[model samples]
Target: MNLATSPATQTAPATLTDFFLKWEKSQPEKIYLRQPVGDAFIDYTWAEVGQQARRMATYLQSLGLPHGSNIGLVSKNCAHWLIADLAIFFSGHVSVPFYATLNAGQIQQVMEHSGCQALFVGKLDDNPNRWAGMKPGVPAGVNLIGFPDYAAINDADLVPWDHIMATCDPLQAVYQPQPDDLYTIIYTSGTTGNPKGVMIDYRAVAEAVSHTSVIMKHNTPNARFFSYLPLCHVAERNVVQATSLATGGTVYFAESLETFAKNLAVAKPTHFLAVPRIWTKFQLGILAKMPQKKLDLFLKIPILSGIVKKKIREGLGLNEAVLILTGAAPMPKSLILWFRRLGIIIQEAYGMTENLGAVSMMPTNDIRDGSVGKVYPGMAVKIDPQTGEILTKSGWLMRGYYKEPTLTASVLQDGWLATGDVGTLDKDGYLTITGRVKEMYKTAKGEYIAPSQIEFGFADNMFVEQICVAGQHLPQPLALIVLSDMGRQAERIAVERSLEDTINALNPKLHNYERVRKVVIVRDPWTVDNNLMTPTMKIKRNVIEARYDAQLQPWYENDEVIIWE
Candidate 1:
C-alpha cells in the first residue's frame, strides 16, 4: 500500500549471463560462491565461476545439441548446481530442475513431459529408496552427465563430471538471450496431485530480481546468503541464484543437514529465508537449552533481556542478519511473536510458483504481526467479488503452464491470475491470508470449515510437531497430529492428557463447524519420502486422508476425545 518505497536500481543487468560477465569484469577476484568440502569451504571467485560455467557451456555445445533444447538438472543444493544452470542458459538451453526428493515415477513424468534431451546429475540425496526409483526412469536417447562426486546410478551413457570440465574448452560463441526468451520451466510441487510446469522467461526473471534487490536493500555486493533450501523451488531460484547475479552478492551452500548449523555460523549471512518447519525446529532447539518459563522471566528483565537476545542470536548464527523471511507455508502468529521476543522480526511473504514468488512481502522497518505487507509496486491486486479469492497481476507473472494452455487459462483470466488463496486486505493494504480456496471442506451438517485456521489455532502447543484437520463428509472434523520428539519420548498418558487440555482450550475459540471434536496421534510423521509432503514441505491432504481413510469412519463414530492411532 504505497509505503516509503526503496526501489531497486533501474540499471539492472540485461540477462543472468550478462550479470555474470559484468561481475567477472568489474570484480573478478571477489568470492562469489563457497561450497563446503570436508572440514573447510572451497571458495570460487567471480572469474572462476564464469570460467567453469563457460567450460560447461562449451561441453553442452560440443554435444551437437540444437539451440533452445530442454535440459534436466537433478541435484541437491551445491555450487555446481548454479554453475550447471548458468551453463545451460549460456548454451541456449532451457533448464528444467527436478527436485532432489522426487521419486522415480515423478522424475520420469517430468523428464518425458519436458522432452529433455540431456540430464545433469550432481550430489544426489541420501535416500537410496528414492534413488532406486530414479535410476531406471532415465528416458532412452537422453544423454547423462554426472557430477564429480558421482553418486552411483548405473547409466551406460554417463559422462563423468571431470571429463567434461577437463576436456571442453571455454565457449566462444557469443550467444545473447532476449528479454522474452524462455529461461526455465519450474514445475510446481503440487500438494494434491501431479506437478505443473510454469514457464518463466528472461523478462520475468529480470523483473523479479530487480524487485527482490529493492525489498532486500541489496544495493551493495556485501549481502551474503546461505543456500540450504531446495534450489529447485522458485523461492530459492529467485531469491538466492537470481538475486546473487543481480546484486553480485555471495552465496554459501550447506553441505548437508548435519552441517547446517555450522555452515550458518560460518557464513553469517546478512539475509535469511526459511519455512515455518525450520523456524519451529530453531525454537525447539532453543527450548531444549532453556525452559520457556525461564526464558520469559529473563525477557521480562531490562538489560539482561538485551544480553540474552544478543547471545541467542549469535549462537544461532543470525547475529549479522538484516532481514529474516518466512514463507512457503502459513506460520503461526504465536510463533512469530515468540521470535520477536528474541529480537527477531520475521517478515512473512505471500506468492506462489506462478508469480515468481514476488507478490507481497513485509517491509523491514514497518512489519505488522499478522499481515504479509502490501502489494508490491508495479503489481495490481484485487479480490474476487463472489468467492473472496485473492487475484493479482504483475510483470513477473509466468507466461503460462508449459504445453498446458487449457490448464493455464483456468487460473489466468483477463490479465489477472486467481491466487487460489482466500484473504482480505486491511484499509492500509496489509494482507492477511485466511485459507486456501481448495482446502475448504463442508461437513455432513452442511457447515463449511477452514482447517488451516483451526490447525494454527492449536500450533502453540509445543508438543505437537504437525497437525492436519480433516472432515470431508463426516459429521465433525478431527485432527491428525504427529508429536514432537520430546512429546514422543514422554509418557503416553501424560502426552495425551496435555493434548486433551490443549484441545479443550482451543475449542471455545472456534465456531461450531470449526471445532476439532477428535484428535488422532499418528504413529509416523508426514515426510517427503513418504509421499505425504511436497519438497517444499506442504502436506498433501489427499494423500494423508487416503492413508487413514479406513479408520476415519470408526474414529468419527467413536466417542473418545483423544484417539490413539
Candidate 2:
C-alpha cells in the first residue's frame, strides 16, 4: 500500500478513493482512534469508521445532494466528526468544519460563505433554543442532522442523523473524486483578525500528509501521540488528523484539562503536541511540587537522579518519544533548556494558515539554540538579505484564500509566499525569527531589539511562565513577566533575602544595549479574550502595551525588579 502518498500525482479520479480504500482493508482491525474518559477508553477501528462513513455517504446522496456539495460540520473532537468528514469525501461532497465554540453569528457567516447545503451538529453543552431559528437563513432545503437524538427526528423538516443512517444506502458512491477536487473548507481562527475560509483540494491535504510523514518517519512505530489541543487549529489538525493517514499510529484524545496528566499515563502516547502555555503550566506545576534546590540535593545522593528523571518522563508519557514538537508561538529558552536536562528534546516550528502549516524547524542534529528549524522537504525559504523579509515555496501551500483572490495575490508573489516574519537565515540554514516585521522597534540608544529575541533571554529562566520584552524609545529594555506561581514564590523569596544578588545571578549577560534595566512580575495571564494573546497564543504586542501602559513608566523608573501590586 502506498501509505505515504498516492502514486497518481496527475490529479485524477479513482486515485483518492483507492488510497483510502487501501488503508481500510490493510488496517481493518488496527485501532484508529481512542477517546479517553475518566477511566475507560473508547476504541474505534479503521474498519468501523470506514463502514459508517460509507453508510453516511450513501445517505447524503439519497437526500438528492449532488456531487461536490458543501457539508457543514460543527462539533468538538469526536469519532463521528471524522467519520462524517470521510463520508463527505467518499460521497463526493466537500467537508466544512466549524468550531463548536463559535457564536451563532460566526457560525452562520461560515455556513453562508462555504455555501454549505447541509449541516451535521453533535452534542452541545448548551443546545440553545434560539439556534433553531438560525437554520432557515441557511441555503434553501439545507438539512440539519443532530446526533444522539438521531433516533427520534424522522420528519422531513429536520432529519435525525441516525434516521438518515438507517434509510440511506451503504454502497460506495459512484462519483470518484479527482485529486484536484475540493475536499475541505477550514476557516482560520481569525487569530490575525477575521477568519478566512481556506479551500483545500484533495491533493493539498494529501500532500500535507505526505510532507509530514517524510519528516516524521525519522522516528518510529513506538511514536505514541496524545491528542487534546483543538483539532480546528491546523497545527493539531495537520500533526494529528492528517498524520493519521500516513502513520496510522494510535491516537488518544485527552479527557479534559483536569484529567490531562492522569490520562497521559493511561495512553502512554509516544508523541504529543501542545501550545506553549499548556507546556509552561505543566513545567511550573511540577516545580511547585518539586523545587530545583530540593531536587538537586536529592540527585546528588546515589541512584536517585536517574530514577527521578526516568520516572518523571514516563509519568508525562514522554518516555518513548525521543523527539517532541512545540509551536504556535515562541517558548521561553529557559524552559527549553530545563526540559533538555531532563532528557526530553523539545523543538519549535513555524508556519501560518497559508503555507499549509509549518515551514521550518530547528533540527535535532544541527540544533540552533534560539531558532525554530531548517526548512522541510519541498519547501524553499529565502531571506531578503537587506530587508530581512522571509519568503517560501512549498507543495503544501494553499491555492489561495477561498474566493479572495485579491488578498491571496498580496502574499503569493511569483510562487513564493511572503511570510510576514522578519528574520535572518544562519549559514547552517537555521532561521532565527526575530519578530514580525511590524513589531521590531528601535531604542533611544539607536539600537534595534526584537521583542521575541529578548523574550528568549528572560524565558531561559525556569521561574518565568512568559515574558514580553519591550522598550521602543526608552533608555533600556523592560520585561513584563508572568512568573510561574512556583517561580513567583521562589523569586519573591530570593528578592526579599537578597534582591541585588538574585538579579546579578540570573540576569542575561547583555551588551549594555540588550539588557533589561528592570522586570515586572505579573500574576495575571495574557489571554485571547482579554486581548493579550492572539488566538494562536502569540503575544499581541499592541494589546499588551495598551492594557499595561499605566504600569510601564513606574517599572522603567525602577532599577530593580518591580512587583505589580
Candidate 3:
C-alpha cells in the first residue's frame, strides 16, 4: 500500500518566509518559540519572532550582499538558529549551516568552500578563543554577527546580534522567494572527507513540511517541538523548524546537554524524533530507575503491566508523545520491541541527506520487525538487483552537491539517487538495510563480513553502549566495544564474564565466518570532540581504524576473549 497516497492533503505554505508571515498574522499572540533562560522559559510570540526576523532581514539587506549570496550559520541548536535561518531566506540569501561541533580548521574549510559573504556565530563553548585560528579562513571583508554569550573574537566587522535586532528597522519589503529558489546549503557531517553541501530548494522544503506535518500529526496548535539536535542536519531542519512553521506549532529549545532531560519534560512534545543513540540513552534512563529483571517480572502481572508502562513513559518524559521516530542509523528490533512493551513505538525511518532524511517511515499500525516500513507516497524506491543498493527518486530530492556536478552525477544517476546503502526489499516493499557497500570488508581468509549485521547482533546486550566489528585482513572479526556507564560501574570481572557468556551464546547462532573472535573494551568513549564520531553520533570507521589498527594486532593475538584497552 502506498502510504503517501492518503486521502488527506495538507496545504503547504508557498515559501518559508510566507509561512512565517502567515503564522504571525493568524496567531500573533501564540507562543512560537520558547527558549530556556535560567530556570525560566523566555517565550517569543509569533509576532515577536517575525519582527526579529524582519529586522534581521533588513540588516542583511543593508549589507548589500549579492542576491543568492551564501551566509554561513555556525551555532548549536537554539532558538536563534531558526531566527537566523528564517532571516537568511527572507533576505534572499542562502543559509549555509555548519555543524557547531566543528573546529576552526573544519569551519574554515566549509566557509571557504561555500563562499559565505558573512558568518553568524552563536552559542559556542564557554571559550571563544578556541576558534582564534578560524578568523583567517573568512574571506577579506566578510561580515561577522555574534549572538549573546558568544565568545569575543578579534574581527573588525563584528556585529552584535542584539544591536541588529534592536537598532535595525523591520524590512518593509520582503523578498518573494520562488518555489525553485535556493533556501539552504546543508553540509553533510561526513565520517570521512570534506563535507558536501546539499542544495535544498524552497519547493522541497515546502513538500517536506507538508508531508512530515501530516505524517506526524503536527496540525494542531498544541503540537510542541523540542529542538536539541543540530539545526544543520536535514532531520532537525525539516522536522522541528519546517514542521513548526508549516503547522504553526510551539517549539522549545534545549539549553545544554545537562538540561536535555529537564527540557524534554518541560516541552512534552507530541512529535519527537531522534537518532538511535538518544533512544538508547532513554532506554538506559528507564532501566536505571527500574532494574530490568524487576520490570520484566512486573510486566508478567497483567494488571500491573499497564501501570508499569505508564510510569515508565511518564518518567522518561515521553508520555505525551504521539509520534516517535528514530533514524540516521538502524535501530535494533530487540530495542524496538523493548520500547513496544512499554507502549512507546519508535518508528525507524530510512533516508539520506540527499533525500532530506526520510524516504520511508514505519507505519504506526503496520510495523514489522527488521523493516524500515514502506516508501512514502510520491517517492519511488527500488533495490539494484545486482548490487543490492537502495535507490530512491522523488520530486523532493536535493538539487545536487554544490559546485560538484561530476560528484553529483555519480550518485544521482538518471533520476534515482544511488543511496550507497545495500539493502533488500521484502515482497511487501519493506526495506531492510543490510550494510553500506563501502563498509563491507573481507578477512585474510577471503570471507566477507558485514560489520553492521554483527553490530546489530550485539545491540540487545545492555552492558554495551556502542559496538563496531572490524576484521579487515584478519582471521576473525574483532568487536571494539564501548561499555555503558552501568557496565563501567560493574565489577570488571563480572562485566567480562557476562560479555564472554554473551559472545558464546551469540556465536552458535552465527555462521562460523561471521562469529566475533575477541572484544576490545575501549577506555575512551567515541565522541565528536575526539573526531571519532560524526555530529549525528555515527562512528567514523576510517577514523577508528586509523586510531586503533596498530593496537588491533595485539588485541587480535591476545588469548583472552575480552581485553581492556
Q: Provide the overall lDDT of each model, using Cα atoms, as 2-decimal numbers.
A: 0.84, 0.69, 0.84
lDDT of 1 at 194: 83
lDDT of 1 by residue, 1-565 (tens): 2122224445544678778888989999999999997679888899888888899899888889889888999989989899899889989989999998876778889998999999988777565454556867878888888777645444446787678878888886636888888999999997867899999999888777666667766675498889988888998887788878877989998888888898888888877899999999999989989989999999999999999999889988889888788999999999998998898878898889999888788876787877778767666677777887888887788999998999999999987888899988776667789999989998999998889988997778888988899979798899998998778878988988898989889989888877888999898899988988888888898899889988888997888888888
TM-score of each: 0.96, 0.83, 0.95
Instruction: Tell me which of candidates 2 and 3 scores higher on lDDT.
Output: 3
After superposition, the stretches of candidate 2 with alpha carbons farther than 4 Å from their true spots are 1-19, 62-66, 123-142, 147-160, 297-302, 441-449, 461-463, 469-478, 487-524, 528-531, 534-536, 546-565
Clashing pairs in 1: none
- Which 10 consecutive residues of model 3 have the lowest summed lDDT? 1-10
Best by lDDT: 1
Superposition error at 187 for model 1 (Å): 0.6
| Per-model C-alpha RMSD | 2.3, 5.4, 2.4
lDDT for model 1 comes to 0.84
Per-residue alpha-carbon lDDT of model 2 for 215-265, expressed as tens digits? 655246734567766566778777766665556667777656568788877
TM-score of 2: 0.83
Could you give the candidate ranking by lDDT, starting with the highest? Answer: 1, 3, 2
Off by over 4 Å in 3: 1-13, 126-137, 152-157
